[model samples]
Target: MTSTEAPLRYTAFTSDPEGGNPAGVVLDASGLDDAAMRAIAAGLGYSETAFVTRRDEAARRFRVRYFSPLAEVAFCGHATIALSVALAERLGAGDLLLDTSVGEIPVATGRDGSGAVVATLTSVPAHSRPAGRDELAATLSALRWRAADLDPALPPHVAFGGNDHLVLAAASRERLADLAYDFDALAAVMREHGWTTVNLVWRESPERFHARNPFPVGGVVEDPATGAAAAALGGYLRALGLVVRPTTIAIRQGEDMGRPSDLLLDVSPADDRVRVTGRAVPIAQAGA
Candidate 1:
């Protein structure tokens, strides 16, 4: 293998290569500067890519950076999951400490029921605040959704676990499924509000949910699998007392897009910690 080869690619949150959010993984990015990483990520055209600058084998610690097509992100949950799975395949499944732009993120690796490698990430402290009425109205207009379509149970709020996300729970699954919107308009609103994505979701049941994320800020129209948003959603749900304490909720995402991704979330009321779990797989090169 050449020392200067391009980064490895992998899909996160799904077992199938074509069914998850694809991300570029640079195992050894210590030599690549910010410009180089940005170029590489842009060339790949994925929602986000992860660069591992340093790794501690015995300590299972990694210093990582995430780059979207346009700019560097504070933290990317899917890319972190992919990196953990990749590291687990090589170093054996265990725990990992990640140093990120936002804060230190702790991740663990294990096997799922089907024996697929699953990585569970414990998000940093999460908090949510009510969204401004004017901003909320603007966001709703950009999304082409009326306030009536919103679920009364879940009020509008800007939630943050790692990145800021606008949480708007839909009144029905159909409202969440119909996701066509003004990309530029929504992008402008999100940019103005400093939101990473708009987390549109619907509660199918007390413990199950359907979500779709519009990520125009990241240069992607939509994100099939979004773990960061999920973590934020967990915090929002708990803070609002929408769910029973200490329960695991299943989040179904990317289904409308045909990718079909699943995320398991455990939220505890004792403290503001949300644990999200998903699987990742390496994407085979043209000819391996």
Candidate 2:
């Protein structure tokens, strides 16, 4: 395909039109500059757009960049899924190395028994640290949530995979369902701390969880399916010893917003990183 051909875009993490997160895809963005890429992403108006440029044919790696409508992001999972599916269409399913600005991300793609492509990304090394007392207080105040509403077992902390996220476990499912917050107020705190999203979660069972993410830093009210945050949560769970070793956990998100998404997380005892897997279907062409 020539540069004049239209870009290939796809939504990730859901098979339905209105479910999952939408991402813009440009299979070849070799000639596009930063401004041009940003303009395209802004024009597309998705949460994020993935731009790929050839870097090495022998290694099957490409230099990738992610842009939000408002600004560039270090990494975006939905976009990565979309790009991987798109590439699989041409090169067939296998593993591809994505050289992102943050780090090198390895994505493995394969087809299900029904022949639908699925992509699983192994995130960068995961780590978590306790949130400062003042920061936690400020975050709660901005969200209008009292300290007592927080789950004492899980404490407030900043978790990092490819990006940084603040993990807050609510005391109850009721608290997790209530999603009223000061957008700008929380945005200010996130900006100050360079956080990507506030990962609010409620544990439904030992292996199941419900989560919501407020993504003020990305200029979005909330993210429907956050793969990066899922990786962080896996790290947090492992750190807290909530789950046994070599177990798979399920996370249900975006239900409150009506775009229900399911994320499967694989945690291993030997590694600190987490592997997140999900299915992504292409949005209709008319909508694209």
Q: In order, what lDDT does every prediction score?
A: 0.91, 0.86
Model 2 over residues 100-199: C-alpha lDDT tens digits? Answer: 9888899999999989888899989888899999889989998999999999988898998788899999999999999899999999999999998899
| Model 2 poorest 10 in a row by lDDT | 1-10
Q: Give the TM-score comparing model 1 with the true structure, all chains together.
A: 0.97
lDDT by residue for model 1 over 1-288, one digit each (tens)?
122787888898899988988988888888889999999999999999999888788998889999999999999999999988988888898888999988889998988788778899999998899999998999999999999999998899999989999999999998998988999999999999899999999998989999999999899999999989999999998889876668999998999998888899999888797999999998998878
Reference-based TM-score of each model:
0.97, 0.95
Q: Who wins the TM-score comparison?
A: 1
Q: After superposition, how far is residue 190 of candidate 2 from its true place, in Å?
A: 0.4
